[model samples]
Target: MKNVVIAQSGGPTSVINNSLRGAIETFLSSGKIGKIYGARMGILGVLNEELVDITAQDPKQIKLLERTPSAGVIGSCRYKIKSQEDLERIVEVFKAHNVGYFLYCGGEDSMDTANKVSLLARERGLEVICVGIPKTIDNDLGGKLQEDGTFAICDHDPGYGSVARNTAINVLEANEENKASYTSDPVLVIGVMGRKMGFITASARLADPRREMPLLIILPEALSQDDYKSNLEYITEKVNEVLKAHKRCIIVIGEGVNVGDLGILKDSFGHAQFSAAEKSAEQVLANYLNGLDRKDEKGRARSRLVVSGIARYEKPGTRQRREIAYVSEVDLREAYEVGAYAAKLALNGETGYMATIRRIPGEKYQVEYSKIPLNVVANSAREFPKKWISENKVDVTDDFVKWAMPLIGGPLPEFANFKEIMAPKLCRDYIPAGLREQGA
Candidate 1:
């Protein structure tokens, strides 16, 4: 009988803890395994010998983990095992604690870490079964586009659906707020989490599938900071057009959108630590647009739009990924099943594999638990399909909506609109002061 050690890495999600519960429960139910231990802060916890005996925890608390959000229970880390000394230290600690099964829950970089540990353990003569459990809101970990346009390997990540639900719901609610408040702030800019992938930002379309809302989505995949001036001008024009047509506009921008010269910090994995940046994409965009002259394409200045109330922005930051209230039932279930399946694989002496979810063909929203080689997933990334991106480059097509709709699970909240016809104005026609100044 071999003891199991599980650790979570990278950013936490609404359903990430549920995956932890799944693995823990599965291991406990299997009489073949010994005591189960959780690393306090990912690989750092193991390196520092900071192992918590999860088997000693109350069963009630374990069950409660199914609803718990984030990695608060056991905690998580961004620490990367790079040096040979760090690798050796991990093997030493596992051997000291008699840990023969290692389960890692995280994204692509975490998968690379697991693969290294598995290989290093064998080199050190330690018989360990290492498995990776997918958990990322970015949805950049694995999967390739098939000939039929469906994704192969892993369909979507566990945290992705929950965050997608969060993004969709946020947009839905923001539309209502913008509709009422557009007289003051005509543009609402929302910054979503997705380092280089647009999946999170694109999920905003799930809110208005009919394309009825006056919205613009800016993705890192669609624009780059290299041509900062050009991109900024193009985006400004789009926002102006929306405001003119609809009187209000909601813009969902990915955190990774190149806004130029943001002092960025890098994590151990060498990825840009967007959260630690001095300025966010939303702030930069809002500021830039606010300074722009409200002029028509013919170079005629307009006075109705003022710089003081041009745009208001919000960076949901971590809330986009960890908000339990927005968690999707589909995401929660898949997260748990992936973890449970990983544990089962480890118990069956399977090593160097990651538990994956494959969307069933002709699915009425069905998926099957499966496994893939850790090497295949390690250090690999999946891009948001170019075909799914609309030709205009500011929106996702119906194809993307079809692919993501099922993952969000239940029916969305319905918004109310009163189609009331207003009575004729009692006073003579009058022009607003600002518009009159512009000679309208």
Candidate 2:
């Protein structure tokens, strides 16, 4: 029997701990593994010799991990291995700990890290099995587009379902709040977390499939921030159109929607660090709209029909990704299955592969666990398909709703509504002072 080590990397998710738990319990039951160790703080833990003996932890607490959200237990990190010295040190530490099997849980960058480590172990003649576990709310890991417009590599990353459900529920609640408060704040701009991809932002549409709400969704894939002036003008026009028809509007924007040079930071992988950025997409759009002079197509000042108040913005930040209350039962189950599958692969001597999920072809929701080459997943990225974007580029098509609706699982939270009949007027109608002054 050989010893095993497990570690997590990159951002935490509502179901990430469940995956860890799955891997731990599976390995323990296999009886082909020795001491089970957890690498604290991801690869950083390996470098610093900070290994936690999972075999010594309380079994009750281990079981609780099924409901525990985030990666606070063994921890996770964004540190990237860049040197031969670091690689050598990792192998040395692993040899000292008698670690023969390694399971890494995370997204694209983590897969790349796992692949490199597995290659290095082979080069150094170390007997080890390395398996990658897929996890990300962005759903950008890797995949091929199916004929039915679904992704094939992994139907969807594990954390995406929960976050999609979160966004849907949030939009439902925001609609209620917007309806009540739009008299004062006519526009509510909600900023969601999804850098470079629109999965998180597009999920808001799932809240209202009938297109009943006066909602506008802005995705980074649909708009180009390089031409800030034109982009701003286009979005302003869309919002005004919605306002003219419905008195109030709700805008959902992705955090990565190129709001033009907000002093963006970069991580080791050179990906934009939106969290560290000074300004968010929603804040920028709100400020721009609030400061506008209400000009017409001729660039002349005009009195708009429903520009009652300035737009208010909210950036939920990490709360969108880590909130346990919003987790989907489907996502939690898949996360655990993938983790266990990775353990099974390691025990069976599989190496340089990632545990992937594929949605079965059927009317009912179903999925099966499989494996894919880590190199392929590490080098590829799945983008929000352009065909899914609406003709106006401000919304997603019904096809998108069909693809994501099943993942969220169960009935969405419902809101209350009363008869919209207006009360009879007691006095004669008169022109408002603001409209009169504008000479309308």
Q: Relative to the unseen true structure, what is the C-alpha lDDT of residue 194 in candidate 2, on a scale of 0 to 100?
A: 90
- Using lDDT as the measure, the top candidate is 2
Model 1 segments more than 4 A misplaced: 292-309, 431-440
Collision pairs in model 1: none
Q: For residues 31-50, what per-residue lDDT tens digits would candidate 1 score against the true structure?
A: 88898999998888899999
TM-score of each: 0.94, 0.94
Q: What's the C-alpha lDDT at position 174 in model 1?
A: 95
- Writing each residue's lDDT as its tens digit, candidate 2 over 1-440 gives 67888999988999999999889999999888899999999989899999999999999989999988889999999988889899899999989988999899999889988998899999989998999999999989878668965587888999999999999999999999999998679999999989999999999999999999999999999997588767777888899999999988899999888767777898887888888898888988887887645666877544332476769999888988898998999999999999999999999999999999998876777899999988889857898988889989799999899889988878898768998799999999888787677454
Q: What TM-score does candidate 2 reach?
A: 0.94
